[model samples]
Target: MLGRVLEEIEVNVLASQAWELYRTLQLAKFIGEELPNVIEKIDVIQGDGGVGTILNIIFPPGTPGFSSYKEKFTKVDDKKRVKETEVVEGGYLDFGFSLFRVRLEIIEKGEESCITGSTIEYEVKEDAAAATNANASSMVSIQPLVMIMEAASNYLMNLKNNKNKM
Candidate 1:
């Protein structure tokens, strides 16, 4: 069966700033510097940080299930602040998923606020459907990513707030 999930979160940051973080390779830098607890490191395996870019998203040592996965950037749209990534190997596939993909979009709501939306698409192998469905709720967890984004946003906001104080 095919499964699709969509979730959105609002952050207190300018749309342009949020778009830049989402569209370019700066996000890797942010995560590495600001969220070392959640994301160990984001290594670019191939291509530039754009369409066709491959990334190894490594989790911390004690992270559950698997350590990392290779994801290919399928689409990158700066104008719309959208990024699409597909799991090429490891991670979810290691858990027996036939196919899996994720899309992230930053929608501008105002001058200082934006909504980050995530869409997950997956297809399960018929044989693994039963087991997959049973543990599905906890299977595909984006909690870490969400946390990282929130922390990054807060960090940027703090920088702005602190600068204003000066």
Candidate 2:
């Protein structure tokens, strides 16, 4: 089974400003600092926030099933303001998912506004048991990504507001 979930939020900031955060590992750090309950920690295993970068992400202890997973940055397009990552080990793979990938994009809307989009693409193992495949399909969700985008939008807006006060 193949599945995808997409969510987007508009932020009152320039696309370049939003991309400054989303285009690199700073977004991971922001998530760790802002959403402690959703993500416990993220450690860089290799690369420097660019294509081929590997990240080992750890979920909070009480997370429903998997605790951690390693993902690799498969695409980092600066001109397009997009980044894509794929799970290379653990996490959803253990639940019978053959492929789990995430793509984040910053779309320019206006001089002072932009849209932050998050997408999750996954495929369940074709030869896996029915239950496992069913379970894998069930695990696909956009809530977590939605939360991240909302938080990031708020954070960037706050920063802009504070800077304007100076």
Screening candidate 1 with a backbone cut-off below 3 angstroms (N, C-alpha, C), the clashing residue pairs are none
TM-score of each: 0.87, 0.96
- For candidate 1, lDDT tens digit of each residue in 1-166? 6788777788888888777777878878788777888888989999888899999989899987889999999999888888999999998887778788888899989878889887888887766767656564457766776776677678767876897899
The best candidate in terms of TM-score: 2
Residue 133 C-alpha lDDT in model 1: 63
The residue-by-residue lDDT of candidate 2 on 1-166, one tens digit each, is 7888898899999999999999999999999999999899999999999999999999999898789999999999999999999999999888788899999999999999999999999998777738653556567778889989989998999999999999
Q: Local distance difference test, per candidate?
A: 0.82, 0.92
lDDT for residue 2 in candidate 1, whole number 0-100: 78
Give the runs in model 1 whose Cα sits over 4 Å from its true position: 131-134, 162-166
* Clashing residue pair totals per candidate (backbone < 3 A): 0, 0
Which TM-score value belongs to model 1?
0.87
